[model samples]
Target: MFKTHFHSFAIALLLALPVAVSAQDQKPEAPYNAQLIVRQPEIGQGSPSFVPSPQVRGMKALSDGKVYLVSTDNKQLLAYQGNRLAWKADVVGSCPTVVGPRKISKVLLGPKTILVTVGERTFAEVDTATGKVKVADGQKG
Candidate 1:
């Protein structure tokens, strides 16, 4: 009886996985120019993989027509140049114990960089042109 109940519970949990994942990605309506930065992966039947979709959380529009989009689904920061994806980085966790998406509080603009706050003291400056992380505190460049 225990084995039978375990099997049923496992099946139920497996069935609910897809629904929970999709619901976690549901987000509010995007901006008028949201189309310019959205990414949709083509997933065929029976592929059985996470499609790396963005849970569009926040976006910043630059004066030069560039766009920066932050995704919590995959912990990524994507840079776009006029509706085309320039580059994307998997900013999962900058430092141990400070996992991304949750640690990140604010995204700011500094000259030609997008500053992603890691904590009260640390931040990562993503180059708007190259999409590379350049730490400001003499650590990385």
Candidate 2:
């Protein structure tokens, strides 16, 4: 009876090992940054070529866990984690209807912050964790 109980206890400990290990192995999700535009560098005829497009947006997901929705080319940015919307915010306010073309000129990333520049005058500061939007007015970006 003693040997039988010892073997059973060993088997029970082994069965619970994975659960304990997995709990300790869990890590907090890190904020991810993705570009609305894709830039490819290629060698053409022994020369370097760098190309960028405004309308073409791409997604590279290992699985369908995270999905990003970009509104009006690159004006607004949204991110969905799993089946829920992780965060949503207007990246660059509504561009003029008749002014220069609407485009994201520069994207700056800092600790827990994301800033997007539109044209030469508009700047948007977005919270990376919660997707909060803060438009900088009369500020040079």
Candidate 3:
């Protein structure tokens, strides 16, 4: 009787050992799928120079490493090389119409051109090399 009971207990222990080992070896679920991208801020010598313009509404970086910023106050645009302001130009023509408190909404940088949109109505295509406003089109809000 004693030997029979000992053999039955041994079989039960062996079966339970495998289950406990596997339960301990199981892995937890992985973290959620998300990626983070980091961009380094460019710093130059002397004080952190900001482009000498009124307000910068939007910005785009070109393939040639030039940065363009749009100024909404005077309906103008400015360019930056490193930390210095390279050039500035008026976007409006001889007959200036009110752009009506517009804010630059989007910017797309191309190989040779940059496109910027203001609010929902106005947009401009600029030459990345020359910092010239190639075209500015708008409609009433």
Candidate 4:
């Protein structure tokens, strides 16, 4: 009777040992960052105003403090100087009008030109000097 009772108690203890070890090894939940804000302002008298939407896709700010936005949807490029939109021009060729894949891949600013690339195709000198677009072969289009 003594041996039977001891064996049963030992078996119970062995079964509970793994559960206790796992509980001790469990990790606590991670804390979230408090700096990010996503909620839109509620409709009220003194709420923060939103900026007017522009017809552009990927927006990039230049070193000259000019904001450049590409409208893949409209097949055009735009430039914003200060709070006012300064320029808008259509991109050459049959490219995706929406700002996504198959659109203008990259934009580079030179002393007097802006270089734009779409996939493997490249446009070397888009003259920004007189707000004119010149193709790579040195012809105005």
Give the whole-model CA lDDT for all candidates, comma-separated: 0.56, 0.53, 0.55, 0.48
Candidate 2 error regions (>4 Å): 1-72, 82-84, 94-100
Question: Top model by TM-score, which number?
Answer: 1
Candidate 2 lDDT tens digits, 1-141 = 999999999999999999999999986543433455332222232311111244434222222334444554666666567445687776556433212336555554444555656656666676656778755543432
TM-scores of the candidates are: 0.48, 0.42, 0.45, 0.42
What TM-score, to 2 decimals, does candidate 2 have?
Answer: 0.42
Between candidates 2 and 4, which one is better according to TM-score? 2
lDDT of 1 by residue, 62-114 (tens): 34555676665535677766546788865445444343344555566544777
**Candidate 1 stretches greater than 4 Å from native:** 1-56, 94-103, 119-121, 136-141
Best by lDDT: 1
Q: Give residue 9's lDDT in candidate 4 (0 to 100).
A: 100
Model 4: pairs clashing at backbone N, Cα or C within 3 Å? 72-97, 72-98, 73-97, 73-98
| lDDT score, candidate 2, position 112 | 54
TM-score of 3: 0.45
Better of 2 and 4 by lDDT: 2
Across residues 1-141, which tens digit of lDDT does each residue of candidate 4 receive? 999999999999999999999999986532211121112223342322112234223333333455455553534556655445677666544333323344455565554566665434534345553445566432222
Query: Candidate 3 vs candidate 4: which has greater lDDT?
Result: 3
